[model samples]
Target: MPIKSLLILISLLLFTQNIAAKEYKWSNKLTFLGFLKKHGIPQKTYYKMHKEDKELIQEIRAGQSYSINRKKGKITTINIPVSDELMLQLKNSKKGYTYKYVEIPYDLIERTISIKMKYGFKKDLYRATKTWYYGKELEEVYSKSIPFNKMRKGDRIILFYTQRYRNNKPYTSPQIDACLIEIKGKPFYGFLMDNEKYYDSLGRQYKRTYTTRFIRPVPNMKRISSRFTHRRYHPIHKRYRPHLGIDYAARSGSRIVASSKGKVVFKGWKGGYGRTIEIQHANGLKTLYAHMRGYAKGVNRGTYVGQGKTIGYVGTSGRSTGPHLHFGLYKKGRAINPARYVSKPSAKTIKLKGKAYNKLRKLVRHYRPQFRETRARKNSIIKKESKKCLNCFKKLPPRKK
Candidate 1:
């Protein structure tokens, strides 16, 4: 072929290749359902995808981007990023549209964060670490001892955690390995332990106990709306009466677990206490759960429930004003304060002598420096910002003529 004809042919081939591999970006302004409709995806295809993967029904948030791959104006594939580390993909093939849930690989990064609280401990932790989910996990780790709501300004916290990243950008919140909260200048340290439990610096488990006599009924709830008191004005009855149980304030439908391994003595409605369940444990201890929405499947009378087994969910069944679990404890058929029984552990510290103690000490030392440096840098930035604001204020002319 002549040179001129060959050049024209090459140009045409390049253009065709570009058209065949074209890409387009789309944002989800409405729900995923609306997006599917807008994209002209058939209802049958959508239903099939939904049936295969229930997560397909999850609504794509506004401003989230999805990429489309087209070959000569016909879409060949679509990729929707459900999260930083997970992508939901649909591809057009000879067999029809195929759905695939792909996990994007992430780099694990270890980080240390130390901050002095100006607001809530949770809020400060999130601000310092840029991890919103860390608050819930940290709260759960420290809920047994630390009164997070009662934390005051200037309380300091140091944490060692791991975060997932893709291309140096964070993908998920930090998973705390160890943390230390200084409340009133007294440091309380929590370290991750076996079975994903938290233990104190002295090696005592936070939520778990050495002895199985007592465990937390509701693991996630941290706030106690009402405690066992001699006499208090009843919210429903509007009269002074002796309150036997402690009311743990949690969202409705929150899991309520068995405090210790026990037999379900009663699992039916009690007149005053709505949707109540009673369990008779070893050592003549009986626990009662009231104001439950419903019982878990197969959790009936005479069912042998293990410790931490979810038996019911929080609800306002009978004599309750809001969603809370009314937890009661009885010893040998005599009513007792659940708080005393729940908080008072048989052992305070797990003995970690010799090699175990040495290993833990080394780990703490390795992570402590990173947190200190981060805290120092943050303090320096705050000081500089404050000084700059003061200078700007001074440079301003005196109040208008």
Candidate 2:
């Protein structure tokens, strides 16, 4: 071929590439619906896309970029990224624009991290894992058996986790596959049995049985603003009175869960309790949640709710100073301390035997050696640090205590 002909062919290829690479950005002030209008997308086509894929409308956000391919000054194709793993593509055809959802593949990467606590468990866990969310995951896994707040100075933790990655960048939060926490030389192991549940080495579920009568109504809340007592100063009443229930300080709209599986005997407004929900469980055990902003949708009187279902949202509905959940526990018809029920371990535990227990044991053994080594190293470091601190203190001028 002649040199002139080759140059003309290269110019044509470059021009085609530029046309295909035309990209547009959605403005921050415009909603997704308005964005389509600004871009000349027809209302009928937008409605058709929404009818076919509701998520396309639900997941759109401002400032997102989309590619637009034009043919003779008419847009032919639009590709919008819905999420890291999903894309919404619309193409112009004789019939109009047609939409299709495209899924992007990602790699699931397994990771292991071991760390000794110099600070709190959350801080140390975050430092070792380099992920902020792993601390919460660890706490949730061990909340049933371990007290994370009570973990001592020399406690060590080993976590085997998995995360999804796209192009070697994290695309999802880390999930705990298995974890071992050693508090004061005692090891507690938690293995992921399934989605939303964990088990011990013996294949016992971390959650209590329904027959246990009571579980934590709000396991995620760490602080109790008020405790059940015969006499206490009322925050609003300005007088001494009996506080019938415990007040769990939580953010407004935070989920208030049912303590046990039972029927919703009452779910409506109460005088000072604001929005109240009461569940009647087996064996005459009853639990109450008060000071809720509103009841969870579909949760009403006569409805049976599961142990961990969201019953209401935290709020200062009536006669309350701030947002908090007033939790009450009852036996037969008498009010009791809700803390007692949660502080005590469940009397009944699901014991796995034979093949089931062995399977869990094998899975735990895979991480045991790693945990042991990590714990040993942590102890050595703590010992050295302690000695160094003692020497430094001795060298300083003594002050009156």
Candidate 3:
């Protein structure tokens, strides 16, 4: 009885295999000689193709696969293969005119991946393989393990994915088994085959690339005015005043913050820039805050302000302007646009916080002391990696405005 059952199972498997391997059938009949007469495929093409591949013409029979090129409603050429002996016979026979095989185009698909960044971090589902370019050949590139965070905005990345075509048509579903993110600063890259192995665009692969960088929070963050441009003739003045600062048009009394850990070098009134405050940051870089309504209590000429600490409120105290904060940056005593240095907070800030907070809340609801160990582990990892950041690269001295 066991032997009989095994035999039945093996037969069923073989039947299934045969069904899967079945060749596709043409939905309708297509002409070979008629197609050639209409397409004007040169006789040399068939002769050359058959001479090199003798079995090509003979093997092409009714219901067999072949390509036809048509112009208007006429067939100009036909290609058929003949075996070596048959080829000679056909050449000699008066009934056989001349024949040639034209090159048949093979289908190829190109896939594009777009990683959208919001203030330089992953915010939404990074799009993969949204558009495809179809051609006879596909361009592909790959790089060995590369760090992700090293990639900056507008950096070009050539990712790789595998595809197969059948009967000169692209398969609707593609196997996107891997991708390679290449950038000049990245350290490593590799394929992500299985779901378990896949990482987000800025996952652990980028952690090391962003070393020594901490989240520099903007205190009472406000919108920025005046984008950096070469032809920046002043918006208000109309004449070129060499706009050194990025205007943040905010309501009066909006808080102004220290960009980094720094000490106030110059405070109080200065020519043209009414209530100006200059904070000399570490490494010889300085941040100048102009047009302040009032200064924070205890923030004076020598006061030390921590990174992101509010030091004053936005106001129009300078050179006759409406309520706004004229934020300026000077390094090595030359002005540069402050807009280039600032970025909005990333989605990771909210996502990481949400994950930890939700987990903690769940533990609290259950009143489980066992969850304490999980919390401790999470905190330990955060503490170890907290100080390491992506922006810790030494600042280059500012260029003249």
TM-score of each: 0.41, 0.48, 0.34
> What do the candidate models score in CA lDDT, each in turn?
0.65, 0.67, 0.43
Which candidate number maximizes lDDT? Answer: 2
Task: Give per-residue CA lDDT, model 3, range 222-301, as digits (tens).
Answer: 56555432123334433222345567777788888887778998788643456878898865577877778888898998
Candidate scoring better on TM-score of 2 and 3: 2
- TM-score of structure candidate 3: 0.34
Rank ordering of all candidates by TM-score, starting from the highest: 2, 1, 3
Candidate 3 C-alpha RMSD relative to the actual structure: 28.9
lDDT of 2 by residue, 177-201 (tens): 7877777767778887523346877
- The lDDT of model 1 is 0.65
Give the range of the ten consecutive residues with the poorest summed lDDT in model 1. Answer: 384-393
Superposition error at 20 for model 2 (Å)? 4.5
Better of 1 and 2 by TM-score: 2
Angstrom error at residue 399, model 1: 70
**Clash count per candidate:** 0, 0, 33
C-alpha root-mean-square deviation, each candidate: 19.8, 19.8, 28.9
